[model samples]
Target chain A: MLKFSKSHEWVKEDAAIATIGITDYAQKQLGDIVFIELPQPGAKLQKSEQLGTIESTKTASELYVPLSGEIVEVNSDLVDNPQWINESPYDKGWLVKLKITNHSELNSLMDESTYRELIAKESH
Target chain B: MESRKTPLYQKHLQNKGRIIDFAGWALPLDYGSMLKEAKQVRLNCGLFDASHMGEIEIKGKGAFKFLQKLTPNDISLIAPGQMQYNLFLNTSGGIIDDFMCYYCDESLLCVVNSSNKDKVVSWLRDNKEQGVELIDKSEETALISIQGPSSSRVIARVFGEKIASLDYMFFTKKEIDHRQVLISRSGYTGEDGFEIYIESKDAPYFWDRLIQEGEGFGLISCGLGSRDILRIEAGYPLYGHEINEETNPYEASLGWAVKSNKDFIAKEEIVGIKNKGLKKIRVGFIMDEKALARQGYGLYLGRNKIGEVCSGTFSPNLNKFIGMAYVLSEYAATGKTIEIQIRKKFYKAKIAKYPFVKINTKSKKEV
Candidate 1:
């Protein structure tokens, strides 16, 4: 399952586990990514809960969890190479993996087309 | 009110510059990737359209005397063809604006912030002496600033080798397309650069010429976003950030520009403030954590609020998070550990000297 949140985070689910990262639009708005701080693994979080922080050359903003889950792993190598998020935000730039706690939560999120329409309107 | 567009608006759009409303003017925020543009300037060169900056020409025989009363700096220090950094202060010793004053044709050309243009013009009018005249030439003039390490080569290609050899802090006249123009060896980016003045109608032509000539030199069109980072890295004061109506020059660490021997607005109050002491002073800091600290964020020593962050950014050249803040003078020493409140958390940072990255501007020796 692939879905996105209104706050511009994208989540990809596979076998009850989901990987997440910020949308390309969010990265562009933030200018250049410099530092990122993610939550430690094994931490439980609810849908739309605070996830971590993403700092850029322009300013700092908070990352949010798209759906309820428990943090299983984080991209630790990002600490020394934060610009990877700016370079390859979708693939290698994935922020963390979370074990799904509520599968139904994905139904409430927007699919690729709906999210695309939302961003198109929002940008204009 | 409609946002005013500069003469080069079409050029900006053609270059894919992201336009933003800045103080009632439409200006470029970035072409793309502020970091890449900033890094390009550090590594090569970048062309900037600074037409939003105001140029107020102080003309007439009494201009020198009028300026002596208007600015904190000793206006007598500069002569024709030379320039000096200056500040405009109010009666309470508050900084009204910081600008570059160039001496030419027995007049002073003060390049001031776009946001403070009206205020500076009104102040000059209200205090005009009998023989002095103030001409606000901002609307008719276009300022194109080419800055960075390779700026000399690019400028020389556009103008002549004579312009490339112009001494730092000096300006000379040139004729481009039969239009009288001015080129100065001065800029705000803390790099080897030139600021060219030409008729507003001729700006687009020159912009294209520079871009064409700058292709081999790796010059990119930069905007306000990179301009902010570069100034912050240089520890230069923005009108409302490091300086304001409440900030005296001494607090902003700009006393070097103030000449105490002369009589000027707020002179007595400024001297008194220096003699008594300053409560807070501006200092630069490096963040120990990768987190960012923004303007208005609190600076703490233990549990007490010691100061406030003025300007903050991630320096591409240094690969470090750096910022400037006004803190209590007692705790302003370099290497002193402090904490910057970034939202709900506090991150460690330490006081450091400015020009966080070594500056590459041409010095007198380079001239």
Candidate 2:
């Protein structure tokens, strides 16, 4: 199941492997994403840690890791083509794959239904 | 903080504008594509609702003389219906606000940024001479800018031969579309354009008509987003970014605007600073790479941090990142090599002359 963070990061996990990317709400606010700084594979990250940076035409924002993990692989394709995040944020724009080190962190994240409500509230 | 709205707020919504709070005003940032809006202005004409900017009316016997003491530029030579770009300076010789002063008979009109409206009003009220009366007319007036290469055609259609005869920095009142309006041949973009000031009640209709009549010429309803890009490409400085309370007009490369003979407010201090020579000065730069040099980004000479970027953008017209920054006067010379630290990576850049885009304008009146 996919869980979301208040900062608009999303992580989908099953067993101990997880895939992460920012939510649609994030991409919209960033506006015309021009550049993305991605983390390298094998980098260790803590829960709520800074992973990389994303810059749009108007502003720049830091992408944060939702849960503690070791990155197994990264979307290097995004380095050359950053617009993928604006085109398909959730499916094809997945930022990183990680070996989950802290499964308990997932319990604190909002589920799909709850995340939709959060987005609705924040949209206003 | 509550966002401020203009008299034409509903009109913006009807045109599908994307609104954002800027300097306390809930202004339209863009309609959709800011790049398209910018190109529309450069290629054709674009109309902008700038009613939120503050307008101050100063009149009476001491009006022009009082302004001589309040601002950095000389206003004594400005004739009626003429406007001059000037700056308000604090006692420390730092810029309080950059504004346009319009000579209207014995009275003068000063237009300032919306964010600094209250502060400017209070300053005028406190420093007002006994014979001068100051009035805040921002609420009663509406400001609109018709800017671009095709702007002359648009204005000619509206005001006929009257607009054609209007000289740059000059204004005249005429009846247009069944309403009395004041039109000035002045603009922020480096293009031939006109700024219209009309009654508050007639704002919506005037805005709608211009947008409609301008449709054939690719007239767009531009917002703040395109305004910034256009101004930056022209190498004009925004108040807070390039000229602030902490930065003086000398450092802003506005020394030419300052009068040596006229004794305006902070004249002594500014003169003293000029004699000593300015340490830091604003300069234009183009990125050696595709990366941007945003506000507050560290400007470097090799590994040493020299200054910070004041305003930056990826100019759609140029298709490259261009910007302005304050560097030590030694590095302010043209062709000086510099580096901007963007997102922890250094991007190579070089100092270039301002107004990267040369505007071909028709102006008979000299500054």
Candidate closest to the true structure, highest DockQ = 1
lDDT of 1 by residue, A10-75 (tens): 899999999999988888777678899899999999988989888887677889999898999999
Most lDDT-accurate candidate: 1
User: Residue-wise lDDT of candidate 1 within B133-194, one digit each (tens)?
Assistant: 89999999999998899999998888989989988888998797787789998787888899
Fnat, model 1, is 0.92
TM-score of the second chain in candidate 2? 0.97
Provide the lDDT at B196 for model 1. Answer: 92
Tell me the TM-score of each prediction against the true structure. Answer: 0.97, 0.87
Q: What is the per-residue lDDT of model 2 for residues A29-102, given as tens digits with 9 covering 90 to 100?
A: 77656677878899999998999898777788898999999999899888656768888898888899999998
Task: Write model 2 residue lDDT over B93-212, tens digit each, in one string.
Answer: 988888999898768999999878889999898898889999899998999999998887777776686775688889987788788888898888888899999988999888887777
Candidate 2 yields a Cα-based lDDT of: 0.86
Interface RMSD of each: 1.4, 1.8
- On a 0 to 100 scale, what is the lDDT of residue B129 in model 2? 84
